[model samples]
Target: MTDFSEQDLSGSSFDRVDLSGSTFRGVDLSGAVIREVDLSNSRIRAAYFDGVRMHGVEIPDLEISGEVVRLVVNGIDVVPFVEAELNRRMPERALMSPTDVAGFWEAFGTMDRLWGETTDLARTLPPEKLHEQVDGEWSYIETLRHLGFAHACWIGGVVLAQKSPWHPLDLPWDEAPVHEGVPWVRRIKPDLHEVMDLRRQRRATVAEVLDGITDKGLGRRVTSATPFLTDATDLTVADCLRVVLNEEFQHRLYAERDLRALGAG
Candidate 1:
């Protein structure tokens, strides 16, 4: 029940240990064998991972948030360390099968990392930068606002439907909320550091809210309701979740472009 962080546990053989919720910051997890390990809801930041040995480890989806050191796949240099970790852990399971859950976990890692990068850019940027317009289009703040609204409209609605007796049938895209006044995209510029911290915190919450989903919950039907629909329909939880990730991918692409145009190029 003790927090073991930033300690030199090198040449240490950690086995059958409650490493869950214990951070391995700047610790080498290379070839560290773990039997029945539970890394659920743990954060690995600034950790040096040559590769850790895991057996029957219950790793509940990792959310990334910055520069990763290395990820060797069969001794090949892969992109992100967290992505490589998920790929390593991908297997076959029933409740939220290994494949589907792995996909979301991988994306969650990437999403966290991207939020870090983009939020860093936003923080360094002044209001003049975010407020800059393109072709009479939305400013960067407006763009983020749009992304936030879409997240709520799509993910929020679907998540609620899954929890309620009546599941969501469709997204009310037309009546979706607008993006403006977001702390990161506020009318008045904020302290760049605060912006970065707030953005990271917000993104983490959003990702966690979606990551807690189980396979059973996903396969079940959720009554979907939309303003455009005369009646709601039952939608598979997986389908609803897909809508959230798909929207995220698309919106990220747009946000990236707009931010790049605003001098983060």
Candidate 2:
């Protein structure tokens, strides 16, 4: 066994080296060349792949999920096409990127109504099924918990400028880095009702903020007390709300998909 920490292995060359099951954390590989590598069954979390070019790659049964700024495939940038298709499938998604106070409120209202319906569907399932994870995704309960966290971070913490808005059961993303004074309890199994209570409180906070929002307020810059955004500048109120809207919209779809997979929908 070997270990390398805080050591610069720049320009290091290896041939026929077997480093299977090895761990690389906080390592720099910005310009490293990888060839003929077998990355089957490998997991990459919170990674950056800017300007990465892959040719002659076999990616059958591969799943990639994240923000897509631009993805070029065979000389075609498909991000716009994908966005257009998504907007066609989910008409309300086009509203998620609203540019006005009224649009923001409408977006939130649509999300609230949709979530209400989804939660109602969830209630018909067995109590234990709500805790079950389908395809290794977040369980029903955990999805709600993560939504609460999103609300707290973007709405309560950033928009309202609160120092601490996290609830005890609020769950951050699975790959989120640990930060002081933020809740990230993945093992806690609160009943659906308890989580719904938290959801109501979080939703109320958004409502209150939206009630007083102005068109000018949407463009007003705000900073967050959350560690992750402490150094973020020029974050507008509208930007924060849009993040919550996207999170809510995407996570609800994920929850609904998982619920059908569990045969509980």
Candidate 3:
């Protein structure tokens, strides 16, 4: 339940203290000694961890979705584990609630509502902060496109098509997908204005597509890895659309977060 992220945790120690679902964005925790940390759902993105120490730290299923993460302790570099995961986590987390689609709607609705407050921040943020670094750098605008491409290509094309009614229509993003599961390699980074326009259009249009679906579409195996298979053994078409909504809204929320960082929100 603790929310303080940047405080001096150098001498602090805890057991059974849940730091999950907490976001420590751009905070300085370089000198902290994190012990027995349950960072299961913690968002440790781009925080300074130069000299941080780890002892008895259990990081099972850790998802380091940060821009830059250099884990060096005692002046020795510890290689962060990497795997070709379908996703870093289970896809069926959408089923965590009574209504499968509620989470997606909640996240996207707030994004749409708040984006108007910070639309100007995109212009104010420095090019370096927004679009300088190769890996870490991404503008508020580009991030949205990156997300839309993933949704329209991978999740929508592969996951939804495999489970739901296969339309097999021509895509604006790619030719026939490379394989049955993966979207064909197509650099879908359209021009900025065009990208944004299409994104908005897709958002509006996907609702109709989603409305005509049912829960059985989730019956097919859609994820790129295991663990999720355990939970997603079957899915309804409606659940599949809900999953798409959930995925899209997650990116929208991420875009809103970056937007607010520039004091736009």
Candidate 4:
């Protein structure tokens, strides 16, 4: 394996390069254009494909799992189909899209219980392993920090109309822009218990919001001036809360999978 770290290969063109079976860990391919490529039998995991435009592409047997939104297939958006199928597979998923106050609280309570179980599993592993990344994915501690950041973004910033609600330990998404007041420090290796304490505090904030939720509040729209969000000018209160729930549920699954891998290792 060749180490090409910190090398500038910009504007370099490869006509018939053989990169088959090559590994691309922590490589940035932003703003790169590919005319023709064969990705048959290729596997992609924990990748971000935001704002990517493709034409004349053939996709078959493609499996995607993550937060998929506004995905258009053949000029038709298939997000609803994907969401409905997912809800059918897991009936509890329907609770994530509740329309009433009681339903929202019930969904939150269910997620809280599920997360508790996952956290208990993490507690069995060595404290240092919680900071280790598995298969190029976020570490267990980073996942918790990201979840706290999600709560601060959705619940505190959007719903509660706070300009900046990020904690010092909160970690934002990788593609998020560098904001003035938001915490984007990825180098700080925080202790596992410290991250969990912050996570518990953020969960409590969500619980407070859920407790105060009403039918009218669910339908109401919230607008905020948070520096972290660029396009979240207008959003429904329920939608913002739902984003937090979705992040919590998805990251819990990711953390569980990584914890199992760590245990087996």
State which candidate has the highest TM-score: 2
TM per candidate comes to 0.45, 0.89, 0.41, 0.77
- Model 4 segments beyond 4 Å from truth? 1-35, 40-61, 69-85
Question: What is the per-residue lDDT of model 2 for residues 99-185, given as tens digits with 9 covering 90 to 100?
Answer: 998998899999999999888889889999999998788999999999999999888888888888989999987767888877667
Q: How well does candidate 4 score on lDDT at residue 38? A: 84
Report the Cα lDDT for candidate 1. 0.50
Better of 2 and 3 by TM-score: 2
Ranking by TM-score: 2, 4, 1, 3
Error of 1 at 241 (Å): 2.2
Q: What is the C-alpha lDDT of each candidate?
A: 0.50, 0.87, 0.46, 0.82
lDDT of 1 by residue, 21-129 (tens): 4544444556655555445655444454444433444445645543345644456656665555644663211112222655666665665666567667765666567
RMSD in angstroms between candidate 2 and the native structure over all alpha carbons: 2.4
Per-residue lDDT over 1-265 for candidate 3, one digit per residue giving the tens place of the 0 to 100 score: 6577556655666677655555555454555555544455444443445544566555557555533346654566454432213224533333323243444455445545544444455556654454422324355555655555544544444444533222222122212224464332343333445555755755654555445434443344555322123344355434444554545545445665665665552
TM-score of 2: 0.89
Q: Which residue pairs come into collision in candidate 2?
A: none
The 10 consecutive residues of candidate 2 with the worst lDDT sum are 224-233
* Order of models, best lDDT first: 2, 4, 1, 3
List runs of model 1 lying over 4 Å from the truth: 1-99, 162-212, 226-234
Clashes of each: 10, 0, 12, 0
Query: Which candidate number would show the highest lDDT if scored against the true structure?
Result: 2
